[model samples]
Target: MSTLARWLLALFGWKVIYVPPPAPKAVLIFYPHTSNWDFFIGILTRSVVRLPARYAAKDTLFRWPFGWIFAKLGGVPVNRRERTGLVNQLAEEFKRHESFYLVITPEGTRRATSSIKSGFYRLTMLAGVPLGCAFIDYSRREIGVLGYLNLTGNQAEDLTNIVKLYAGRRGKHPTQEGRLVFAAESARSGD
Candidate 1:
């Protein structure tokens, strides 16, 4: 898998910049998720690093003829409209596995937004795992898990640290870069 990933990355001109955390359990959150291409690139990078991570996507993505492929690739279908306790469910997954990495595109969509969803933060805290800040810096043509940090239970302070990790990284669509704030945070602040 790594060989194929390397070959494909070389063919497409991308550099692998993976730096996974030592901990087996983590919530790997990808920032500036501005393009659908992040999914494919992320999959390739995961293969290159041989990281086993599961990710949640809208339920629609898990439907139809090609849904099996997505599921086979570790995709979890999620219903945004439903009031399911996904965070708790996923936390249980962590407890069930000795090693688990839940990759989350907190923006929840490729479109730009003022803030990201809070599920990633909640999941990390609930599961008692580190948070990995992954990136796909299009400007540098580099992609992979970049940094990991233990949350201090202070949302504001923790967000600052996460932002620092991605200071200079630019997404494929710079204009669509999402903010470091969480949806609930911004909403409470009336942003």
Candidate 2:
């Protein structure tokens, strides 16, 4: 799978850089998710780096035939309809697995937005795991996980560092790329 992913990326003129060692448990925050293609690119990068990561999706996506396929591809379903302790569930998942990488797109959408969702940050703080910064830089034609962030639980300061990691990295659709606003501002503005 890794070989196939590498070949596909190379065939498409995409390059991976600064691959980090797979973490036993961590949150992978992929930035600038400005296109549906970001999902495919992210999957390819995950395989290329040989990371055993599972992405979170609404429980609805785990319904029928596609559910099995997504499961095989490391999709973890969450019931978003209610506050069902998803963070706790994921935290337990980390405790259960010797290795787990939970991939999240804080932008939470393909269209341009004012700010990022705070769930990813809250999840990491609750799970007692480090947050990893991964990016798809369309301008550079590169995709890879840089490394884990040194989070101190201060949302604004920590987010500032995360944003810094993605400095100069543009998305596939630059116009659609959302500005990563702080969680407090996002909440206050009802984004």
Candidate 3:
């Protein structure tokens, strides 16, 4: 099914707009992840771009016949409710792997939030890797990595730059005011 999706996307001329030279070993950040279609578009984007990216899904999604399919499509099962420290686990995974690229949705949900979660930032920092921005703009029919940046741990300033980069850019999903709100909060909190 994954291969079929890739082939179909290719036949339709769905291509990557831009990809960084010497793709860095890092986590890929996807924003406004709000629907199931985001998965299909993301897969198509990865296939078209030939990017080795993986995304986290719920543990329940890993069960049954679909389990193999999801695994083949680079879906990593995550128990969101568990008390385990996910950043630590991801950092360990990065440490063990020479080249790892994981896709994370900063929104963390299909519904809108007033603030974006800081997990992706923390994970990238802990793993000592850069962060690449990926997006699916339905209106433009493009799915690709826009750019990469080194996080300086100044959440406020860093997020300001990121938001500016992605602003006015349509995504496969919708963005709530949360990202902007969080950016402001981070500035105030000095996080």
Better of 1 and 2 by TM-score: 1
Where in model 2 is the C-alpha error above 4 Å? 21-23, 187-191
Candidate 3, position 77, lDDT: 83
Output the worst ten-in-a-row residue range by lDDT, candidate 3. Answer: 172-181
Give each model a TM-score.
0.95, 0.90, 0.84
Measured on C-alpha atoms, candidate 3 has an lDDT of 0.75
TM-score ranking, best first: 1, 2, 3
Give lDDT: candidate 1, residue 140.
91
Which 10 successive residues of model 1 have the least lDDT summed?
Answer: 182-191
Off by over 4 Å in 1: 188-190
Q: What digit string (tens of lDDT, one per residue) describes model 1 on residues 1-191?
A: 88998899989999998786879999999877998899998899898889899888888887888899999999989898877999999999999999998888888888888898888988999999999999989999998877899999999999999989998999999989888887778888887
Q: Which stretches of candidate 3 lie over 4 Å from their true place?
A: 1-7, 10-15, 21-24, 172-191
Question: What Cα-based lDDT does every candidate model obtain?
Answer: 0.89, 0.83, 0.75
lDDT of 2 at 188: 91
Native-vs-model 2 lDDT?
Answer: 0.83
Q: Which structure among the candidates has the greatest TM-score?
A: 1
